[model samples]
Every structure is written in structure tokens, then in C-alpha cells.
Target: MRAPTTPLRPQPDSLWRAIAAPMSTGAPLARDIDVEVAIIGAGYSGLSAAYALQKRGVECTVLDANPIGWGASGRNGGVVSSKFRLSFPTIASTHGIDVAKRMHRLAHDGVRTVEAFVDEFKLERARFEHTGSLRCAHTERALASICAEADWVRTTLNDTSMSVQSRAEVEHETGSKGFVGGVLSADAGTILPLEYVRGIAAGLNARGVPIYEATPVIDMSREQDGRVLLTAPGGTVRAKQVIVATNAYSNLTEATASYHRELVPFRSAMIATAPLSPELDAQLMVNRRSYTETRRMMKWFRNVDGRMLFGGRDAFGKEGEPTGFDALQRAMVALFPQLKDVPVEFRWSGYVGMTFNALPHVGRSDDATTFCLGYNGAGVAMASLIGQHAAALALGEKPELALLAQDGLRPVPFHALRAPGVRLVAAWYQFLDAVGA
Candidate 1:
């Protein structure tokens, strides 16, 4: 109904931007062009799809409202977890064990996909690390579930790399007594997410895929010959196929209005501490592993380049409000009492797409348009894998993974009231988590 404004720019002091390598610039779309595929959004999903398409000798062009990786792809916590937003048992119960197993395997492969990309492209700046991840139990009741899930993963999935830690073990490994216990997954790890996405963009650029920055697709129309005509600010693209990969930052164009309504975007905020002293680092994060608590409204943190970067829910606070940051700081101090006096160097926020079913989707929105989005905060690994799948679908090939084919996008009920509804849901979850209900 209204023109889409330019996406917000990344904060100048964001840790990712501060450490990011200089990026090459791409000119905006200057004139009309024709291609086999046109990809909107240059984040991980779109860039990954473009890369995959190029590998298959397909012609595709990528367009972004902002520079590549300007969204959650760059501002995220960098936890390369090979898991869905929903729990494994929940997925199994809902989708059957066979489908659940397939989904698990797909997630595992998603992690490997990132590993392969880093290695094949020699993304030295990505600073990819295989340090593993910990899912800490915030309460004693959560510890039981954590242990049970770890056992299920080991026995059912035959994943020997995952194990449940006892309370003492968790405290010893994390140097924090706040966690009752945890599940350690050695296959999971972390990476410089921004660097990884930028690396993919660079690789795609090298392969001759024109990436148009500051080029927002304003509208899309179907041509008589079944092509999709995408109109941007500077020019137009007539493509045989279109892939909508905008995710949380999706604009409400006529082409994407219905699908965009299916996604509920909530702000996820983070704070990075000034470099911790080596002794403090050792005292706090003994294993330097990425970690997230087992709470519905969760907190995630990791030791990144000698600093502690942490994030959590921001549903209760607006963009400029300090409520979210204050809560995060308190949580950080509660976990590591020694960090109560630590200085926070950076604070920022980004939108994460939440789906009604709490699972990411990838499929055809229409005969000529395909999409991959709604990661529900687990975008790092899932987005990359889904992007590749979207590329396959674009080329008229079946996706190798069946996870994307399940639970296609459905608009949330009372979509117009989503903001207040999400805030209420967040408050309820917080209360439940607080009371260990």
C-alpha cells in the first residue's frame, strides 16, 4: 500500500562492522536486464542461492535494499547451531520420527555446508571456529529435559558428538554456576557471520552474478510469457524465475504482501563488552564455547575475539529503549558475577522472523516465485541450506532435503495485532521461565 523505505543501516560501532574487512561496492541497477533468475535480498539466503545457482551454470542477479549482510546475517550472535528453533522431540511428535530424522540430518548437513564454504573459498577472515556449543539449563527442571534430549540425540540420531553435562561439569566448563546443567554438541560452533556472508557475496561476484546494492524491488508483475518482471528504483529485471529471500527485512510489495504477512518480525538485541582481561576471560568462559540457556525467552553468549558478546529477547522494548540492554547486562552479571563492572562497548538490535509454526519454510509462493525464509532466529545454518534449496527449486530441480517442504508459510492469526500479541507472548514465556513452570 505504501512505498518501502530504505532498510536501516548497521550501527557504525557494531562489532561486525568494526572488524569487517573492506567490502567492494556494487553499483545500483541502472537499466533493464533479463536473467534466468532474480534474487531479492543479499543476505545469507539470497547470496547463498546466487552462489549455488552460479555453480549450476544458471544466470541470476541479486538485489538488496542495503549492502549485503546488513540484516541479522551480520548482526547475529554467530552461533552456527545445526538445530531448528523447535525442539527435536517436538518436531518428532508433530511430524513423525522419519521426518524428524530427515530434518536432523539436514541440519547437520547445514553446518557442514558452512564448513565447506569456508574451506573451499578460503574465507580466512571469517574466523570460523569449531569450538562447539552448549545449551545450558537455566533451571533444575530444564536440566532434566536437556539431559533427555541429549540422550535422544545420541541414541536415536546416532550422534556421538553430543553429550549431557552434569551440573558440576557445566559449571566447570562454563565457569558459571548459574546453569544447572547443559548439553554439549561438539559438531556445533561459531563463525564471524558477517565475514562468512561477505565471503559468499564476494565469491558470487567473482562468478559474475551482478549484485545491485541499494536496489529494492518495488513491485513485481507477471509477463505474458510467464516471466516475472521486477521493478526496482533504478531499473527493472525480467526473470524467468524469482526468489524472495528478504527474510525479516522483507518489504511489503504487492508480490510479497501475502507471504510477508506470514512472518512476524521481532527485534533481537545484543551487547558486546569491552575486551575482557585474560584472567577474567579464563575465569568466565573457561572453554570459550558458544552457549544459550534452555528458556523460552533465552539468552545466548560467546567469547568472540577476546570480548563477551551476548543477546536476548527484545520484545518488551522498542529500538531506542534501554530495557532490553539492561536485562541483558543483568543476566550477564548474574551468570558471571565478576563481569558486573565490565564495560559494554556496543549495543544494537536486529529483527528476527518468527513463523506461526516456529519452523523455516522454502517453497513456491506462486508458479513463478519461490521463497526461503522464517528461520525463527536459527538463521545462520538454516538460511544457507534453505538458500541452496531455493536455488535448486528455481532451476526446476527437487530439493534434496525434505525439511523445507513441510509446513509451508501460513499467516499468523490477527496479523495486524502481531506486535501486541508477541509482546504478550514474550511476557508469558518470561513468567514461565522465571517460575520454572
Candidate 2:
């Protein structure tokens, strides 16, 4: 892969770089060229594609409008738990039992892939500890639902490790005493988002994958010979195949508007407290395990660098996205009243693409281009795993997993009425959770 005569560079104001340290970048591409494949968006999906393809001896170029991990892959909750939040009956009904099971493994094992990379590369940024995750519940019915789901997965899916944690155990485990009970994931873990991205990008680049930060694929067209032509400001790239890995930022890409109509951009916000007192850390977490409470507007968090970093809530709208710190901080205190006066050191929010069905779409498009996207907000481990499968599909290999690969392209009903559309749905959920309806 030759460098272009000119290369794409990052914009003046990149988000991740604003808060985190800088990433080392290579020289820009200078001219139009072609490769085996071309990918847009440098987040998990794009980087994962580059990593997997490079390992397979495929020469590919990756472009991102900002630095690697600058998007949600760098800004998400960083919970690598692999439980598919959607119910089994729904998944099995849509994609069939066989396909659902494979996708299930793909989801859970996404975390394993991350663990393997961290182990192989020995990067400090991938500081993952597997204490397992806890899903705390507020009601007996919710707890029963959790147990029933776990039993169903273990019995039908042949995953026996899935089990239920008693209410007493959950209260002991998460240090959050507000819940009556919870579900414990014996196989889950957590990581620092930016750190994980850096480690993977660095490891892949070291192994000869051409990972380009600050390059944006402005538009893509098809060639007569069946290759894809991806146009960036610096130059163009032609490839035998292309993968649309832009999850949220894909909205900014011209082709993505149609793809994202059913996919709503939700603002997931988070706040991190000043380092907890040594005493607080010991009493606050269960083996440093990560957790997400059973709220309609759920609260999820884990330990990071001595701070209790927690995130939850759909930013009511664009305006809410910009100022979620106060609400989240107050929510944190309300849940764990002991930390009432703690100062939250950092706060940030980014959008996650969601589908009404809550299932991610991965399939071939009308233009013969392949797509692997819409993991809802659970991209940490799932993105890497799905990208591998998507790359396999791009190579024309049949995927063994049963996913919503060939679904319709219909927009979510009432998108123009989101305040009435989604906001009402959210309100209903909150009401149901509150009144036990």
C-alpha cells in the first residue's frame, strides 16, 4: 500500500484528543490508489476490520475524520459484558434459533477477543479485570425475569454458566444498596475505552496494517470492475470491497442518512468522580466488578483509576446532550447517598445509534457493498467480534451466525415526531418502571 501524494488530517477540534493524550499518526496519502479493501470510520468497526484483514494478508486503508477512537468507541461506557439485552424469543423469532445462538456467542466472545488482544500485546491501556458484571433489579418481578432469562439461555442455548445472584448477594457485590436483587454475569469485565482503542490500533499498525487517522471517506462510488472508489479530501482509494463501519458519525457521511433513518442517535452521557477515598474504593465495589441497574433509564458504572465513573440516561434531545452532568451527578448521589458531596472530575457525552428492534444490522447492500453496524450502544466487545464476521462476509464467505443481516431498510415510524415518537416511549418506560405497570 503506497502513501497518497496528499493525506487526510484531523480537524482542528477533535474530541478525544481534547481530553486524552495524543496518538502518533503516519504521513497522509498523496494520490488516488486502490487496495484489497477500503473502510470508513476509525472507531471499533473500522479498526477491527483493518486488524482482521491485515492479519489475513489483505492490504487495506482506514480513514477517520478524527483520530482513532475519537468516536463512541473511545467515548462509550466501556462495559465489555456480552449479554444481548434483547430477549431470546424475539431474537430467535427474527433470525431463527441456529443463527441466534451463533450471534449470541459472537456477542459474548467479543469480550474474549479484547482479552486476547490485551494478553497478546501486553499493553497497559488494556487494563481489563474480569470481576464479572451485575445487573441490579428494583423489583421481584424484574428479578424473576432475570432468573427466567438466565435459565432459558442456559437451557436452550446450552450455556450453563448463566446463573442468578440473590438480592443479598447483589447488595453485597455492587456496594449499591438500593436494589432488591440483581443478575450476576460470571464472565464479564471492564476497560478504559481510549486505552483499549490505543492498544489495538498500535498493535495492528505495528503488524503492518495501514491505519490512517484524520482521514475521512467523503463519498464512495462503484467501479466498472466491481471495486469501490472511496473519496477523501486528500485522495481516493479503490478496493475490491468496502465496509461501512461508521456507527454514529456515519450520520455525517452522505450515504449514511438513508441507512440511519431507523437508527436514532441517542446521547449516552457519563460522569466520573474525583478518585474515591481508599476507604470508599474498598467498600464501594465488588471485586472491582462493573454494573448496570435495572432502571428504564439505567445507571451503569465501574471502577477506573480509583474513580467511580458512572454513565446512564438518554440525553432528552440535543440540548440535553450538552448538559447532562448535573442530572447524572445527582443521580449518582441519590443511588449511593454516601457519596453526596463528591466532586465529579470529568463529564462527557456522545451519541450511540439505535434501532427500534434493538438489533444491529449486518448484511450486503443493494450496491454490493457490505455493512456491519448498529450495535445499539454495546460496541466495546461486540464491534470487534462483528467486524471479524463482516470481513468474512466481504470476502464472500457465508457467516455462521444468524443475525438480522437481510432486514428491511424502513425508517423508524414518526422520526420527524421524535419528541413525540421516542420521548413518549421513554416516558412510558419510566412510568412503567415507577408504578410497576
Candidate 3:
């Protein structure tokens, strides 16, 4: 395969970025300044933290290495589901059942938090839809797991919003017979992710929190008096407290190296088809719910404005390059052959931060520095919530989620080998998925 002559664009071409409403990200920081709190990322978590801090009447500034929503926050498939990579049973087995309940509730709260932001800011352009989410089973084993999960959600959590669906029901709902069966959760939904995050930034700007794009924090240090100093190319910020919310892009700078070591950043590729015909839209995703198949390396898609937005954990060749569009297209065609002739208008990829624990981590790295990341592909809703948790932690308030409140940055063992390790694990999962293991 021939590599592109040019390196990847700072922010690759994406469906969301192309159609999102315009919003200014402000000029980069160009002079020394002091603030109560400083945030180092313009993505969902950092922006959310800035919003929470400003609400508390604390002065804060957000800095980013690129334009606003340039990371996974802008590149995701716009699925606003509050589900985590781990299942309820796994969480209950690790923590107690009560803890598992709290985690589940917290996940739901994440979804509500985004909705609250939309209502507060009147972000109609965000195009949020509370139409719920459907998880289809790709195999018999997966079908059993989906049914068990739906049962746990209904009986144990007392959440009547979740239900299991038969294969025929799944086909009728999704217009695709590729799935064996499925589970539906009314607590989930969909949104224009880039629009949502950018809307948050706009609201923050109006509320006096300045977000500086193209301003990367290159170095960080602690003062003798417990204040944190972040040095950027054009200026330096001395803040009483700092929240690092860079997520998978944390490794781009030595300043966030410690946080980077804790995560296994995996690339997720996506594709979007040109607007589907009314008939095609009606046939596929009739209810406009976020849809995913139950596979170790899963595929997710949804209907957005009569278009099919599809994505998966498939990437090839070099990092930051657009090399997996064909694979994603093949997957989409396999599921919906009718779409095989549809024109693909967008192809992009972004990193998702994964942790060894398979759960997001939030806590202080030091007295003046706090961090929240490792969403494992659930960043849209979870990041928005955890950003607030990181802000509360910086302000000396306890985080609402007990699991995160007790957790700190746990570095991966032998972090240098993450690339090869991730590849090996991904190949193993793909093989298992292929053979129905």
C-alpha cells in the first residue's frame, strides 16, 4: 500500500466537522496569565471541566493543541449511549453489586448531563435525540449475553427501560437480519457529537471562560507554594489548580507523559454514506436509534439526517493515517448490502483511551494537578461527566462516583510495549470473534 505523501491533517476530514455549526475557538494564549484553574484540552472533558469551574465562580482557561473538538470528541460516530465497555456482571464480580448499581446510575447520569447541557444552552444545532440505543447480537453466545444483561438491568437495577428483543424483532427494528437478537435501553440516545462539544465551548465563552486553540502545553511543573505552572510556546499559565483532560492525545507532549503512560490508546475508524433515499432511511434504522453489534471488536452505526454513520475498531498501517476505510465499508456492506452502492462521503479515525481496568479513572495526580480519562470508547457522555468530577476534585470536593473517587492514575506495566501489545490483543479478539470462540 502506498502511504499518503502528506502527514495526516491536524484534524482529519469528518462528517461532524463538515456539517457542524460554526463556532470560534478564540486565539491562542500569547502572554503569561494567572487563573484559579487551567484546563489542558479543548475536547469534551476539558471543556466540561471549564464549564463546571466557571459555574462555581472560579476563573479558568482552556488550552488545546488544535482547533476545538479536534480529537475523538469531534471524530466519534455520534452515539450518545451511556454503556461502558464492561458489562454489569463483570463490574459486580469485581466490585460489590451495590457498587455496580452506582456505576450503572453514574453511566445514566452521564447521558442526562449531556441533555442538561443542551437544555441549558439551548443547543438545537447539537441535534440531540433521546431515541434510545439497541445492541444487536452477532452470534448465539452474544445473544445469550445480551439477554442476561437485559435481565440484570431490569430485575437487579429495577430499570424497566431495558428489554430483550427476539431475532425477528431486531430485524423489524433495524431492517437488518445480520443480527441474531438484541437488547434495547431507553436510557441511551444519539447526538451530533462535534456540535455538542462545540456548543459547550460557545456557552463557556459567553460565560467568561476563554478557550485557546492551537496552544499546547509543552511543559508542566509545580511551584514551591503548591501552584501548578504550565508552559506553552507563546505564554505560560500559573494556576492554583490544573486539570489534564487530553485523553488519548496526552502522549503528544512530555508535560502529559505521566497521564499518557496510564492509557492504551486505540484507533477507531469510521465512514459516513451520502444521504440515503427516504425509502432506504425508512428501511434502515426505522426508529433512528444508535445501533451496535455484540462482538469483541464491535461495529456501531446510526441514522443521522437520513445518512448512515458507521464506525468500528478497525485501523491499518501507520498511526494518524486514514487507512481503514475499505475495511469499514466492507463491514457495513456485510451488514446492509443495500448500502453497498451508497457513496461514502467521509472517512476518518481517532484514538480512544483504554485502561487496564476497563473503567474510566478520575482523581488527583498531585495536590495541584487532577486528571480524568481512559473512557475506552465511551468518551462522549462519560467524558462530559468525568470532566465535572475532575473539576470537583480540583476544588477539594469529593467525586460523586465512588469508584473514580478512590482511583488514581494507574500506569500500564511496560508502557513502551503498548503498541505491539494492543495489536496482539486486537488480533486475538478478532480471531476469537471469527471462530465464535
Against the true structure, whose lDDT is highest? 3
TM-score pick, better of 1 and 2: 1
Residues 226-312, model 2: lDDT tens digits? 778887767778888888788766766675555666577677888888878887887787578888887777889887767788898
What ranges in model 1 sit over 4 Å off?
A: 1-12, 252-255, 315-323, 406-409
Q: What is the TM-score (0 to 1) of candidate 3?
A: 0.96
- How high is the CA lDDT of each candidate model? 0.83, 0.74, 0.87
Candidate rank order under TM-score: 3, 1, 2
Candidate 1 lowest-lDDT run of ten: 1-10
Candidate 2 Cα misplacement greater than 4 A, ranges: 1-22, 25-28, 89-100, 319-321, 407-410, 413-420
**Candidate 3 lDDT, 1-437, residue by residue in tens:** 22112222356678887887665546777888999999999999999999899989999999887888888898888888777888877788889899889988889989989999999998899899999999999998988988888888778888888888899999988888899989898888899988888899999988889888878888899888888899887788999999999999998778898999989888899889999998999899998899988888889999887888899986855555767788889989999999989999988888889988888888888888989889999888899888998999999998677566635667899999988888899899999988987
- Candidate 3 residue 390 Cα shift, in angstroms, is 0.6
Clashing pairs in 2: 4-29, 4-30, 4-31, 5-30, 5-31, 6-29, 6-30, 7-29, 99-402
lDDT of 2 at 293: 80
Candidates arranged by lDDT, highest first: 3, 1, 2
Error of 1 at 346 (Å): 0.2
Error of 3 at 318 (Å): 3.5
Q: For residue 303, what is the lDDT in candidate 2?
A: 75
